[model samples]
Target: MENPLTPDALLAGVRRTRLVAIVRGNDGPAAGRAALAAMEEGFQYVEIALTTPGALDAISEVRASAPVGCFVGAGTVLTKQDVDNVAAAGGQFIVTPSLAPSIEEAAGRGIPVLAGALTPSEAYEAMNRGAAAVKLFPASIGGPGYLKALRDPFPDIPFIAVGGVGLDEAAGYWGAGAIAVGLGGPLFGDAGSGGDLAPMRERARRFVALATQYDGRAAAESLR
Candidate 1:
């Protein structure tokens, strides 16, 4: 396997991709397959949430086999131990559902974190603690209007809209000034649970096409 990219380099990759795929499943191998499939289809920044069974193993497996320039990371990370396990499994990045201690722990090890937050204070606090970007969790509640409002205060902070984000709502998120859009259920469907991947591939293709068409900058590295 290749050496992990530095936090800045990883962030650059994320910035260039403008999409993050969150994978969750009932089993390890299945989740790994789902991740690999997404990576193959241009979802380069893939996160296998720790909530999935045997996620660490999946991370280890995917890290060793992911496509070049694809990143395998652990998500829904809630504690320090989770961070340690992910790092040990060779996860190149870390993502949290909230402003958990794992964010600081991962940052301490030079691992980049997409710290999750909803409120303005929480988002600012996450960035203050060294997060490479802020993940606006449960972003559905307020929609693009809310994201736009948050950007007003933190004009320079990169915000990734997560939770309840789907294909239909993606353009709104982007227009609202999101640096990247985080996706899970709408993209994965039941693929991670041993469901058919053909449909998943189709969905991913549509997403990639939309992203590349919407932002040419993201296409430069994401489509290649």
Candidate 2:
């Protein structure tokens, strides 16, 4: 069955939210709870990475519990089978750590994909291959300047900075033209430690505030 959420809608949601909370941990239940906490704190997009133990089940759990209009997607997707599994588990989107055939597979199934890329060539290739957006992995290494340079030539391609994206850096990436920002450890914290969720909620609130502020500023500037 085709997902009710279309690629265009997913893309628009990403642009509107501008923050993607990446949930990963050893305990599936904890991961699910963390996702819920993030959603409760106003994050509309969540990616449950396959690297987490029982991540598929976690995805299903979060999907079943997340409020309406929230997007639950599968992260670390590497194969066509992963795509099928995520779709079966009610994932509305796919996020890969690298540019792969999986992007094409997701596109074939009408599922939007954000494939990871580190260079201009890789990003462009991923876009050409049907990725809904390109995730600039380990973005901290290049920081916002690198993303700005990448956008210089291919301004049309949507970019999502992931891997090492701190809460403080969210606005910088948005200002640099990123459609959205993906955060893992910085957002969820060490889920393995069984820490309190209050910190996560605080972090989520901070990120959301920064993204909203920058997004509004950009929109206002566009009008002028």
Candidate 3:
């Protein structure tokens, strides 16, 4: 079987989750629990935010405990130090809230960096930076239509839709050319207060099911 959690394999996991929960809590335990729940719920990609306490430790712990198919990534990485931290923690990929030049430096080592972008120009520049994919952040404000518009000119770039993306709108974004979607509070709620993870797991499972259904339809059409 092909390995799906490798840095190069993040895209497949993206289709499965369509919703990556960014978790940052008071300590390693909280982050681990949140990340564990996300994986249990069928989410293959989990991001432990750099702002969280012991983020790298939490990532290493989660990476060790998570099922083989799960992809653990570091989020909100801003500097070369953050990149080194995640890499040392064994994180397969890195995600930033905004495009940064340091991100290019990190990705050069074969680590997949999902650089955030708000415009076509930004997205194109991010791709030029050797980014594995461009994250369309605050996508709600831009909307799925914006992604579709961007695709007309820069269709080859892999776009991960982020922010304000929920089950109700995931399909719209995917249909509009988004390769994946990143979700937060809606899926996991607040980490500081510690959410009821069982419900979040169910919600994540439903997202996988919904994305699978959409993929089925799309594949069928393509075969015709």
Candidate 4:
């Protein structure tokens, strides 16, 4: 069955949820399981990083089994071939850790692409090159304050705060004007280490609750 969420809808959903689970499992099965677990805890967006082993297969598995309205995307995508492979694997979107021409390919296919950028120049360049959004990588280095400052200029550009974002920091990113936060180890933990998933599920729930709380706050502020 075809995914019901379109590129624009996917971006809107990310903004609505304000949380994206970055799944980097040790293998395909682990990645799929982690994605399902995150979804079970109310995460509507999931990004399967290509750096993971068998990531393409993992994306296919997660997309096949994900429930309706769940958006599954490919992350850490670096090459044009990677973008095409992700599309072939049923990925609904694309996320790269750096600026790349492959972003145009994803956009050409009507897949929303979030290209990484740390500076205002890079962000503008990314948007000009057809990125649906700009992902602030290693966001912890500058933290929410940095993101907040970046938003001052590019008020219209959607920003996804990725890398080193903890569960407790998710709301801070939202408050900093980020459209969404991408969480990896802090949310999924080392699921590949044969650890218990119950704790991870609990963390995921907490992250969702915090994100939703912030989303409500943002909505209220908009009304004022």
Provide the overall lDDT of each model, using Cα atoms, as 2-decimal numbers: 0.88, 0.84, 0.78, 0.82
Q: How large is the C-alpha RMSD of every model relative to the true structure? A: 3.6, 3.8, 4.6, 3.8
Please name the candidate that would achieve the greatest TM-score relative to the true structure.
1
lDDT of 3 by residue, 129-217 (tens): 88878899989997989989988999789899989887777778888988888877667676423656677777777776776677623
Models sorted by lDDT, best on top: 1, 2, 4, 3
With a 3 Å backbone cut-off (N, CA, C), the pairs that clash in candidate 2 are none
TM-score-based ranking, best first? 1, 2, 4, 3
Compose the digit string of candidate 2's lDDT tens values, residues 127-172: 8888888999989889989999989999999999998887657767
- Which candidate, 1 or 2, would have the higher TM-score against the true structure? 1
Q: After superposition, which runs of candidate 2 have C-alpha atoms over 4 Å from their true positions?
A: 215-224
Using TM-score as the yardstick, the better of models 2 and 4 is 2
What TM-score would every model get versus the actual structure? Answer: 0.94, 0.92, 0.88, 0.91
TM-score of 4: 0.91
